[model samples]
Target: MTQSPLHILEHTFGYREFRGPQAAIIDALVTGKDALVLMPTGGGKSLCYQIPALARPGVGVVVSPLIALMQDQVDALRALGVRAGFLNSSLSPEAVRDTERALWAGELDLLYVAPERLIQDRTLELLHQCDIALFAIDEAHCVAQWGHDFRADYLRLNVLHQAFPQVPRIALTATADVRTRQEIIERLALEQAEQFIAGFDRPNIQYRITQKNNPRRQLLQFLREEHSANAGIVYCLSRRKVEDTAAWLCEQGFNALPYHAGLSPQLRQHNQSRFLRDEGIVMVATIAFGMGIDKPDVRFVAHLDLPKSIEAYYQETGRAGRDGEPATALLLYGLEDVVKLRQMLGQSEGSEEHKRQEQQRLNAMLGLCEITSCRRQTLLRYFGDNLAEPCGNCDACLHPAETWDATEAVQMALSCVYRTGQRFGANHVIDVLRGSEAEKVLQFNHHKVSTYGIGKNLSAGEWRSVFRQLMARGYLDVDPEGYGSLRLNPSCRALLRGETAVHLRKDAKLAAPEAPRRSPARDIDPVDLPLWNALRACRKRLAETQGVPPYVIFHDATLREMVARRPVTEAQLLEVTGVGDSKLARFGEEFLAVLRAEDYEGAI
Candidate 1:
């Protein structure tokens, strides 16, 4: 007897129901129709195709860019008793031949391949010999030439449609705006596919953005206060910063590692493996590090520098709290981040139109950082989703920002920039306004300017806030010549001439850091702590024996459920979420033994 999709969900994957549009998507693919799915990171997008592959008649071919993570993905599926395999550079020739044999013999329900490999003439020819169920193009946004994380190899994926016109294809991504969506549809030849745009909201993850003030110290304080013993990722803008930050964090007694394109492949793989397998390890990396990470319990994602666009920021931060538990996304940015990012963008070799689009994206990202209203509302609106009311989870909603009339302050700052030849950066211009007799101010003889010392009522930090907001609001522009000079934009003319009133978000004074609100073991009761540790130990042992990540056996969420319910028998253990038949047959006895021992010890 064949199992229905719902039956497979319950008996194999251990879920009772599908999430969002997952059921509809599976129905489409199982009926031999194509689909285009835009779901969030933790939205169970994989299930949309995986279920159809099991319910339908042939092997599902997944085109993935994460060659390094393909083995982990396959390991995870196999843990759930799904016949999954992959062909990537990580495999030996013998292993590749073995996997190919499995595919030809109809032993695999799913086969994962890199786009580069799948587009090869040899791979395409080999696929033509087998029965293909459906093609899933993961990370579908990479097909967009103007999008972040573009890959040349993805452009050739159109061949899948041309070669296998009768086979259904599903393209999926976690991030894409209207333009990129159109690009994916066109590039992949998915014009006839049904579009499923799920809501792009991660309410469990709190959003926090703050101005950079001695950012390293700020990061340390954040770690000590909120995520002291949790796993997280810290993002930097450069490889050197990644290395430096990782070293500094280790000095501060954190188990932090650096990951960048500059690291040797062996070391990078080792570091990534440890981060996935160990508890309370932090990975500090550049943008190149996290395109396809599937870790679910990341407690936080911190940015010491600004991201290039809201889309990039969304994609990176979405890695946290993927298990639907509470997570935090913290960002600390300053005017210097904006300057550095703009300089990099200006130096890019992209066409003029591409450069302009990127500049607009950067400006929008700055607007998100500087907004006094609800950050989540503004963030979702950027992606074409609207929240009916303010999301009380973001920093702005939690601590409402105060604004003040800064008309005079704006006039003083812009006039100072104009009077100082508009060639210096924010610091020098701010010095001229705040009555600083610093050496540079004296060297340039800027004291004679009429705007000099006109804004002495505000402190240096306050002036910096004004200038940062000025740049964020488009009243000031960074020079395009790669210099850090500040120039007055045409938009600032009305403000400088006192024709417009400027209301700026008042900077909050540094307060004593709050105590960690959520514990590493948030849901487990104190009495169950020992049992939780024992269960985790059991899972770790099993993972080590299998040579896979611990989460592949069971997510933290599933473990927490076990701790809460204390299932001691086969029936009770099977009732726990994520306890499918294959997992029960494989490791249920070990977990039950642990639970029974704890109960017996408690009775004593």
Candidate 2:
């Protein structure tokens, strides 16, 4: 008799139960059905297909986007005693031939291949010859043309359904808004596939966004205060910024590295390998760095510049705290960031409709930044997920923002813009409003206007914040044709006429929290610290010896559990969440030795 999926999951993967829709997805695929799964990062999406691959008769072909991702997945699967291999450029010719031979002989349960390779005629013919159980398309959002991670290779994936109509197919993505979701379904021809939309909230991550003021200094402060000893990723918008920030962080005595497409392939791979293998390394990178990374203990993701869209922001920040431990997502934005981003969008090559859509998306991102309510609620609502109440984890909830009636301030700002002829940008308009005697204010003779000096009580930063909120709330618009000149929208007429009241978060008091002196790992007991360190040391040593990522050896969560529970025997160890039979046989003795030593020490 054949073993059940639950048996394979418990014995091979070491989990006693399935998470979210894993069991349902696996059962559907195993029984020959298609699915489109939208799960958050660290949500156990891999198991949705992996279990089906093991239970089904033939090979489960995974369409992966990156070579590193394929290699990591194969390594983890092999560690679980699963028959898995990959066919990608990273593999040597002999190894490719061997993998191909194994697939033909029905010896492999799962075969991971890049989309570019999978779409090839030669590869298609070979796969057609094999009895395929299913085609699992990882990162399916890449097929969306408007998506941040779009790939032309993904456009060819429709061939999978065309050629193997009888085989089940499962497409999975961690981030996709409603539009992108529809695009994935239409593009991949998955109209008949069951759609499983999981909750988008990653509750473990605490979200915070501060207005950018001396971004480098602010980033350093955030690092020194909150995440000095933890692994994190700092994202910059440009390659130059990435390099400079990484170098600067290194000078500050952090293990920092730069990763961008401009770097040589060898250097990129080296930096990525270092980030994956080492603990407490900060990878300062452009958007090119993340996507397929499987590192689990990244404690935070900091954004030094504004992201292009909420989708981009979500996907990038989602890289952190994949182990379900508490993590931080910090973003710093300023008016200049909005101007630069809008300018870039204006100059970018695209159809008029595309540009309009991009602008709308940017506007949505700006709204998220300026929201006075719970950040998590605002974020989830963008993806069509509603939180019943405030998340109480985000900065807005932890330290609620104070809103003030900005009707008068907004009226003054808009009047100033109008009186200044709406031909000048924010700085000039702000100068006129705040009664500045700067040359431009005098050059334009703006100091002579009645609205001039009306905003003298508000500081430049406060005025800037008010203006940003006005633009975000649609009472004001940035005139791209006029070099970012502030223009009053028709809606401002109501406020300017006292017909409407505007409220805004008081920007002056919205300072970031001071760094706490205590460690984030305070949940661990004092008595368990030594044992925790011992477990980590043993795991790190094993990772070094095996030459795989440490998380692949065992997640930090698993180590913490071992320290807390102090399992004494093999049977007790198997009760741990991540302890599968394969890991128990391979690493059980080493961990047990450390635990037993700690136990003996305590007894003595």
Candidate 3:
């Protein structure tokens, strides 16, 4: 007999209730219906499909793009006492055949296969002989050609519907704008799928964006103050930067490692393994590092350079604080970062419309950085999601940015761009405005211009801030063909002519580095610290024996609960949020023993 979704969710997954639209999505899938789900990270998206897979008869064939994480994903399920296995290149031929036989014998509840492997004719033929419950396409946004992370194999996923017309199919993703959503529907032939948008807000993450000034030092201070000894990701725009940041962080006594496409495959895999298996390993990487990572307790994600778009930013930062704990997303960006991104965009071999869309996305990212209001509000508005009130956690809400009437400064900066023949970048324009006698200023005879000495009151840094704000607010445009020169937008005519006033956000002064005021981990009482360490040690030992990451055993939240509630019996242990029947049976007594020994003084 088949179990109900709620029964599976509680007995198998140890959750009493569904979060957000999980129950509805699961019901639709269990009843042989299609679905397209857009849920944020840590929003329990997996349960929407996993529960249905278990509740329904036959094996759930999950088509995922994360080939590297297939083992971990299946391991997590197997830990839940669900019969789960995966078929990918990582498995040996013998192992693959074993998994296939298990599926044939109806011994597996779920089977994960990468898109590249699933598209194989032999794999499809083998699946045709098996009892299939449903098909789930993970990371559905990869189907969008213009998205930040596009996989060609995702384009061929429409075959799932054509081949398995009688089987229910669901597409799931954590990040998608309206355009990307439509693209997924079209590309995956999911027009008939019921859409479930769980909104794009990650309230547990604190958004903190600041202007770049000695970014290495700034990142150092941030790590020292808030995230010292916690696992996090530090993103850089280039491989060289990733290497340098990783090395510098290591020199500063951090357990940092570099990961980029430039690294050898073996080395990259080694570093990634260390990051997942070891505690407090900071992986300094380029954009290539974050997709498919299932680590839930990443306390922070810092960016030494600006991402190209808000979508990319949201997706990357969402990796942090996935366990629903307080986490930080710190981005330190500068005008040069913007220029570099635009230059790369301009050189792309995309259609004019595609480039235009990309530019708009970049502009939106810049707007998020410069907005003086709540960062979460502006970020959510971009995704067509609305927060009724300000999120009181972002840097903007905690310490509001000061705004100043910069109408005169903006007008002067615009005038300087115009007087410099519109062929100069912000540095040249600012130099001209501040009456600099640099050779470039004299070489172009810019000193003779009327605007050269008119803005001597503001410092050069101040003028750069003004120009950056102007660009961010759409008053100024960058000419990529002209080598990133500054040009005034026609909309700026009103401000230049004094018909409109401009108010720009003043950059906050960098504060001195200090230790974190509070702990990034759960707020356990000092008396409970010993038990907390004991539970963590037990979890680590089990994880090592099982050859999985520590988090795969149990999250820190779960351990904290074990410490607080002190569950002594099997029934009491099952009451913990993450403690399901499988976990309780497999490791319940081990944990109960630790809890019973309240005076256990083992150090972590």
Q: Per-candidate TM vs. native? A: 0.97, 0.95, 0.97
Worst 10 residues of 3 by lDDT: 512-521
Candidate structures ordered by lDDT, highest first:
1, 3, 2
Clashing pairs in 3: 225-516
lDDT of 1 at 252: 99
Off by over 4 Å in 2: 508-521, 598-604
lDDT of 1 by residue, 1-604 (tens): 4579999998899888999999999999989999999999999999999999888888999999998889889999999999999998888999999999999998999999999889889899989999998999999999999898999999999999999999999999999999999999999999999999999999988898998889999899888878889999999999999999999999999999999999999999999999888889999999888888988888899999999999999999999989999888999998789888877887889999999999999999999999989999999999899999999888898887899999988888888889999899888988888888999999999988998889889998898899889888888888868388988899988987788888999877433323343455777778888888888888888999999888999988888889888898988888888999999999999888888893533422
lDDT of each: 0.90, 0.87, 0.88
In the range 84-142, model 2's lDDT, one tens digit per residue, is 99999988999999999999999999999999899889899999889898899999999
Worst 10 residues of 1 by lDDT: 509-518
Ten contiguous residues minimizing lDDT sum, candidate 2: 509-518
- What's the number of clashes in each of the models? 0, 0, 1
